[model samples]
Target: MPPAKLKVGLVQQAVSDNDKATNWNKSAEQVAKLAAEGCECILLQELHSTLYFCQQEDTDAFDLAEPIPGPATEFFGELAEKHNIVLVTSLFEKRGSGLYHNTAVVFDRSREIAGKYRKMHIPDDPGFYEKFYFTPGDTGFTPIQTSIGKLGVLVCWDQWYPEAARLMAMAGADLLFYPTAIGWDVNDTDEERARQHGAWETIQRAHAVANSLPVIVANRTGFEPSPNPADPGIQFWGQSFITGAQGEILAKADADGETTLSVELDMSRTENVKRIWPYFRDRRIDAYDDLTKRWRD
Candidate 1:
């Protein structure tokens, strides 16, 4: 039997400063538009309801985080049901008092959250101080079952880890979706910026090739100022994109613009490409004991 095909929409847009209501409304408009255009699934950028505010460690930002079935998920649930489409969204989840996580929720067409994946690799790099805010995800590498198909959902930092990708693929994910909020550090040299962006894109593309599964990456755009006046804020290079099983770029956006990229995937291509490449079949799983260690040394 031929593999099923589905139309997926990726919303690549810039977010405002700490304006949750506006951001949610903007995302809803885009979702509605995509549904009208006949898309079966829609993916939004990471932390779509707020700016990439992790640049500074402020106690106030924690207030932005809400419960899973709280206001944001409820809003998305209604939208999913009204549009009759599966929705993928990333949010700051308030698991409990003083405990929060960067989570991606998958809503089936029935408007209910089927499953969610909390980001595992929380980066504490200079401008991206996520560790101070997000508690590392405890939800293991598992695919979220949806009306469209199984969704291998991961957050921004997790995208760089091969183990994360491999585990999801091994768990029978039909496609991988990455909701990202990455940006360029303005203080870096031009060459440094180019190298950083290139590495980021290359790593994720390689994941698609290795897994022989389509990958969708939705990123935010525009320049957001650092809440702290001392440091320069990051300039987000949108360039959201989608890649096929062979790591071919199907669609892409520009550096600073709002774009909704819709692409159709031949879900069957995964099996065909995997058969020819056989990366999984030739894996040295038995010899990979060191992968569980924090470091080889």
Candidate 2:
């Protein structure tokens, strides 16, 4: 059984353009600090090693991809062992010369890889051209087992899907972690920006309520200019947060700065919440065959 009470930390930091070495060093320092603060598990934002290169598809960006047990994993593994904290991190995975994936790696305090999850959803929006870089994950919706418990690890785009959360919950995940990179276009109006941020927060909280599990999101913050001067850059709204089983906000960070958020999760609350709101027991699985169909034509 997993521990009843667990303290988790999130590193919501800004990224620098084309500076992977500096980013790794800074993140390691943050991890060390969180470990000192008694955080049992630490989560870093998606693509934390460098800028969000998916803003525009460039052929050279493929150079950023590295093997699973490559340098990046080794660096984080040493940190986990040194601090004796479970660490969750996201990376651009290089499967081979022509294949790649958006993957999350979980490390136990023993300095060994616990498990990994390949992001299932791939978004291809204007400033988030991910489909061009990542191949859709074939790893399915399996949760990663760690010392903390089963972790439903998903990427930015996967957080928006209810099916993903439900599958992870059914598979016995104690908490869901989204290592995300999302933001607004500089051209968007102030009102539109607020609406976007509100919607983002609401959707993830709803996932927590539906799954009867805590939801933790770690997102990058600050402004990253577009490579092409003609296009508006992205202002990554930080607001990293942790929510309870009932969708109550446990802790939230600011919108524009780098910070580490630590929160305690009561693992036993899921049972109490689910007993009163038993959505899982009444699921109409037999009547949802059309969910798998492309269209009902």
Q: Local distance difference test, per candidate?
A: 0.90, 0.91
Model 2 bad stretches (over 4 Å)? none
Q: Give the per-residue Cα lDDT of candidate 2 at 56.
A: 93
The TM-scores, one per candidate, come to 0.97, 0.98
Q: Which candidate achieves the best TM-score against the true structure?
A: 2
Q: Which stretches of candidate 1 lie over 4 Å from their true place?
A: 1-3
lDDT of 2 at 214: 93
User: What does candidate 1 score on TM?
Assistant: 0.97
Error at 267, model 1, angstroms:
0.9
Write one digit per residue (lDDT tens) for candidate 1, span 118-194.
99999998889999999999999999987677889999999999889989999989899999999988888999989
- Alpha-carbon error at 297 in model 2, in Å? 3.0
Displacement of residue 206 (Cα, Å) in model 1 is: 0.5
